[model samples]
Target: MPDVLQQRAGVSVLVCDVAGPPVATTETALDLIGNASFGGAEVVALPAGRLDPSFFTLGTRFAGEVMQKFVNYRLRLVVVGDISAHLAASGALRALVAESNRHDHVWFVPDLAALDARLAASR
Candidate 1:
């Protein structure tokens, strides 16, 4: 899959389609943010595969640190694609997704269609 920057619901977004844990640290997150900012993207949609598995591990600070970079830059982030298997293994991650979805900065969704809907609704 190819990574691309796109516009959805009048919002600029960078959609990453790379396979397997592409983003694992704050630096990686910042890199994405920088690219998105340069492209005038207010939101960045990353495939689940691009994220390290440890990101879903609640005990680790990986998710928080990575997400913090987005928040600090005021960029909206969407972790796109399915994460049912991960959620099933950890109640904390499930809760986190539920709560994060209630806000505008970060979101976890099941697919591209769902992400499009979310962007639409926000507008």
Candidate 2:
């Protein structure tokens, strides 16, 4: 399936396919932001599996770079899927996720349902 544009809690969202290309660099992040913009989406829901392994490692700064790109573009980002394994391996990442969840710019959810609930609550 291709990436789909959807509406959740009245918010426009671009739900990326799980089988889509991995987001491993800032360029790819820009591509996603551009896609979201072109699709008239305010948010991008990316499956966690599409993220590079280094994104979970704070030392690499990959996550920060990619997330910053989304933030700079004024688009929200939701990373959906199980990331327990990644969280268990990095304390910094755990803190980052916790902090990010507290904001409106970036979020990490277990599934699309969770993302829906979050979007509803934010509304």
Candidate 3:
């Protein structure tokens, strides 16, 4: 399946396929942003599985770089999936997730339903 444009809580979202190529670099992240922009989506919903393992390792700074790209483009990035294992391994990552969730630019949610709830609350 390909990435899809969806509307959740009256917000346009580009929902990426789980089987899509891993977003391992900033350039890859830009591609996603471009797709979302082309689709007129305000948000990009990327499954956590699609993210490279380095994204979960805070020291690698992969997460920061990719997320910064989204922020620079003024697009919201919603990482959807269970990241318990990653959270368990790094306190810094855990804190970053916590901090990111507190804002509107980036979020890490366990499922689409959670993302919907968050979108609903934001509006």
Could you give candidate 3's per-residue lDDT for residues 1-123 as a string of tens digits? Answer: 999999999999999999998999999999899989998999999999999999999889999999999999999999999999999999999999999999999999999999999999999
**Per-prediction TM-score, please?**
0.94, 0.98, 0.99
TM-score quality measure for candidate 1: 0.94
**lDDT string, candidate 1, 16-123, tens digits:** 876633897888788789988998888889988889899999799899888888999999889988899999999999999999999998999888899999889988
Instruction: Please give the distance, in angstroms, between residue 59's alpha carbon in candidate 3 and its true position after superposition.
Output: 0.6
Order of quality (TM-score):
3, 2, 1
| lDDT tens readout by residue for model 2, 90-120 | 8999999999999999999999999999999
lDDT of each: 0.87, 0.95, 0.96
Sort the predicted structures by lDDT, highest score first. 3, 2, 1
Which ten residues in a row are the worst by lDDT in model 1? 17-26
lDDT of 1: 0.87
Off by over 4 Å in 2: none
